[model samples]
Target: MAELHEQLQQLWSTANKSFRNVAAYGKRNGVKLSPSTVKGWLGGVVPDSTTALTALVEYLETAAERESGWQRLPGGEWAALYRAAHEAKVKARQKTSAPATTPQRASSAPTLQNSTSPAQPGDIEKARRILKAFPLDASWFTSFEHQASFHRIHDSVQDPLYDGQNVLARNYKVRFLDPDLQRQSEKFHDTVNAFLHSLDHMDADGKSGYSQIPTEWRRSFRDQYESLLRKLSGQRDELMTEYGALINLFNERGIPLLPNGS
Candidate 1:
């Protein structure tokens, strides 16, 4: 575990200082992470939630791949080392997070009888009433709106490609080349897929279609989608906000935003 921690720390260190800024960006999204927090995690102070770990991993991966051209390092050594270290860290964290077990069961316990009893008239009537009240139409409409909203955002983001003429062709070309924009495009794709899947099972009962879902199901989905939308909005804003900061850094070192080879 300690060796894994060391490897993770080294991996984090290899990326440029932009990593710190990215960490700060993640913190703004409610991650509460600093570069030091990443250091601590790599040193075996596991993050309390998988969400934190996931955010850290995603930021690091994106930063590293951005810096390293998305190519595997020579001999695939860096990726191999990172994978092993990450697996170990995950296992250790899971062990730490699992609930403690009790040594013994309580003495007083009820036994079940095998005899089957038919449903009472009142119970059958209650179930029928409940099923009659299930919100299938509402679920279907909400799902449709969710899918449509995602598609609209997807199409709007691709508007840059049209450049006033060949919109579809231009958008495709730009997305193929622009990593930042591509990530947003992929996220929109995934959200749309998830929304579709949710709709398929939305009204299912006991894992079947038409089952009553928890009251919070739609609310939770809405919350998570909203959070992701906000993050995407932030990332887009940062392209502008950090442009000056990045330009200044490059200018101080006599480097142009576009290198000579490109």
Candidate 2:
């Protein structure tokens, strides 16, 4: 275990990054742990992935290997350990952060089983958190592990029909929430589009153009990216189950299908 900490320090030195960078890397990869966690990990403290999902644990493990030249240590061996240790914590966090799931709460938030009520503020907040699971950042695509972690989120911010099954705005669409969420949804979609555009433009203009555009884009939107994504994806995925049940209704109706409008 002492050797593990030493190796971690070596990786930090080799990468020329501070402990803060290490912590940020873990959080960005979906673990929600900090530098302190990374420091503890070095001492065999075994950081929690904060959920039962194996992907988050895999991400942090992969990130550790990539950033530091560690040849897979005990941390990689602890998916079960981390999951067991953190499952309670995950439930605890959800219990505290999430809104009540009572009959009235479910109705207010729109449970397809019973209600299609207008989404409340709590629903919005929950969806935003879920959407962060698969953010549109280019940095997210560096590895299959990273990419897989991304797809885990059912996001429809880009095209309501992009995945049809996972749109944040469409999922939370209510008489009261729909208009505002749709508008906010556009911002999320636009950011993703801008990223794709930046990639297209990256080769032609250089990374400089990509960086400049987001500064301008980020300024246009007032909300944080993480928050918005969670709000949208959570409610969206919750609704998709209900939406799928009415495929007959969709096919019965003549939804326009046009390509460039002949």
Measured against the true structure, the TM-scores of the candidates, in listed sequence, are 0.26, 0.21
lDDT (Cα) of model 1: 0.39
Query: Model 1 Cα displacement at 41 (Å)?
Result: 1.8
lDDT by residue for model 1 over 142-164, one digit each (tens)? 34334423211222222121121
Cα lDDT for residue 106, candidate 2 = 32
**Residue 114 in candidate 2, Cα distance off native in Å:** 66
Q: How does model 1 score by TM-score?
A: 0.26
- The TM-score that candidate 2 achieves is 0.21
Full-model lDDT, candidate 2: 0.36
Backbone collisions counted per model: 10, 11
The deviation in Å at residue 229 for candidate 1 is 34
lDDT at residue 41 of model 1 (Cα atoms): 52
